[model samples]
Structures are given as structure tokens and as C-alpha cells.
Target: MARKSGSSGEKTRAMVEEAATRLIARHGFAAVSMRQIAREVGVQAGALYLYTPDKQSLLKDIMRGHLQHLLESWAAQAPDPDLPAAARLERFVRFHIDYHILRAEKVFISYMELRNLDCDNFAEIERLRRSYEHILEEILISGAAEGVFHHTDTRLTTLAMIAMMTGVSTWYRDDGRLPPDAITTRYVDMAFRLAGGEPLAEAAE
Candidate 1:
């Protein structure tokens, strides 16, 4: 049967992706199947092909889409280029924590499903992932050039800072002791220290 067109098709496609993400995140990519995704989306197994060629493609798309949206969102909300590097870094730390806090599943899939992707698909996802990392690398480089951040290696520091921030998704809870804002503040302070810079006076308070 031909795939439905127009808004219905769009809706089904979105549902397929959502179901795939949720299932893959919960059960692991190797454990998920197209049939399962179709069931979750309330469609026939064959119907999933309308939106994705195969499970690999679905996984790749999910990872790519997540990274692309992440990059786009950070670009939109990033502080002005003229802002001090510390200020920009603060924005990044807060944004990373806040964004990933509510997106634990997506974050889980993006990190844990990489080994499941085929070589080509994995390369593409890695490229997209690297692009997001480069954003932080640039900030670290700028801070170092300004003599504000004193990291010996910008790339290493960038990776460390990102890993530290992204780890929040693993254990965060709305009912957890600290609120999101408090977590962000502490992470921001940690990020500054990781970069060999002191937190701004206001951020320290």
C-alpha cells in the first residue's frame, strides 16, 4: 500500500521516529526491530519503510536529527560573539545541562547506540557529533587566547567539559535534591574550573 501523504503521513513519520527513539533508548538498538517500532507507532511492519529504509537508517536518522537540532538550538541561543569567552562558556554549560535534563532518552540513544550503527552511518553521526563539540572547542580556544581560560589542551578540555555536563542526563531527576537551576549553576562553576578559569563573580554567588 502507498504511504499516506500530507499531514497524516507527516504525523506518522514523526510518530515512527518518536517510537524508534523511545524503544531504542529503552531496549538498546540491537534489541529493537522494525516490527516493534511499527507496533509502537500503530502501523503495519511494512509501513515503517515509508519513513525509513531500515532499522539502521532509522537509528542513523534519530542520532543525526538529534545532533542537528542540538547544534541549531545552541547557535540560536548562543551569546554574541563579542561576549567574553567566560560568559559564552557559561551559556554553553547552562544550555547543555538544561537541554539534556529533559531529554534523557534522546541523550541515551545518541551516546549508547553509536556502536550499533554501521560504519558509514556511524561516520556520519560522528561528524555531526564532532560539529557540536567543535562549538565548545572554539569557545575554549577563544578563552585561552584571551588569557581567561588556561587549559593546556583546548580539545581535551572541551571533551572533558562536555562529558561532565552531558553526564547530568544519566542521573538527573525532577524530584532530585537540586533543582535544574542549581545544577546548571554548579556545572557552570565546574566548567570554568575545568577550563582553568574562575567563575564570574555573579556565577560564583
Candidate 2:
């Protein structure tokens, strides 16, 4: 059957994506089916095809959409290139923490669904993932050059910092003892410590 036209089709497509993300996150991508996703979205199974051609496409789109939005969001908050590395590094830590903690489901699926991706899809996602990681790597490199940061290895430090920040999604809760702000602050401090950076206040002087 053909998809509904106009605003209705657009709304269903968005709903399908949201439902798929939620379902895939709860039950690994391999365990989910288009029928299940369609049920969750309150649409017929065939209607899903109108939005995404197949299960793999849905998975790929979800992961790609999440990463693209992440990169764009960071781009908006990205610090001036002229800013000191310490400042830029701090900005990254805070942005990463704030971003991932709020979208736990998307973050979970993004990491957990890679194994389910076909080679070509996996490579594209990996490339985008690396691009995000490279942001931190470059910051670390710049800091080392400015003598504002010190690390044994830029690549290793970048991965460690990202893993640490993204780990918040695993256990953080709205009712948890620490608010997001407090958590972000703590991570920012930890990031500076990891980079051998002076506190932001001290670095500004």
C-alpha cells in the first residue's frame, strides 16, 4: 500500500524512527523486527517500508542521524580556534557530557548496534565516529603544542575522555543524587586533570 501523503507521511516517518530507536536500544538490533517496530509506532508493518526500505536501512539511518546531530550540535558550541587549548578542551568535555547524558537511548544504540551493521554501513558509521573522536584528538594535540596540556598519547587520551563522558548514560538518572550540571562540572574537571590542564580559572590568567 502507498504511504499517506503530506504532513501525515512526514509524521509517521518521524514516529517510525523514534520507535525504532527505542526498541533497538532495549532489545539489541538483531532481536528487533520491522513488525515489532511498526507495532510500537502504531502503524502497519508495511507502512514502515515507506519510511525505511528495510531493517538494515533503519538501523543505519538511526545511527547516522544520531552521529550527524551530535557533530552538528558540537559544531554550534565549538569554541573559537583562537581560544586556548585548555578552554577548548573544557568546552568539549562539558558539551559531550551534556549531550550524551540527555540522549541515553540514542547513545546506547549507536554503540551497541555497530555489530549488526553490514560492512559498508559499518564503515560509514565508523568513519563518522572517528571524525567525532578526532575533534578531541586535535584539541589534545593543539594543547600539547601550546604547552597547556600534557598527555602521553593524544589518541589514547581522546578515546579515554570520550568513553568516560559517554559512560554517564549507563547509570545516570533524572532522580539521581547529582543533577546534570553537577555531573558535567565533575567531568569537565576530570577532563582537565586527565589532560594535565590547569583549572579553567587558572588557565584564563
Candidate 2: residue 99 Cα off by (Å): 0.5
lDDT of 1 by residue, 89-184 (tens): 999988999989888999999988888889998999999899999989999999999999999988889888889999999999989999899889
Candidate 1 pairs with clashing backbones: none
List where candidate 2 sits over 4 angstroms from the true fold: 1-7, 202-205
- lDDT for each of the candidates? 0.88, 0.87
Cα-based lDDT at residue 58, candidate 2: 86
- What are the per-residue Cα lDDT tens digits for candidate 2 across 1-205? 1224379877788788889998988888889999999999988898788989999998898889889889988998899989988888888888898888889999999988898999999999999999999999999999999998989988888888999989999999999998888888888888888888776663332
- Model 2's number of clashes is 0
Query: Which candidate achieves the best TM-score against the true structure?
Result: 1
Candidate 2 — worst ten consecutive residues by lDDT sum? 1-10
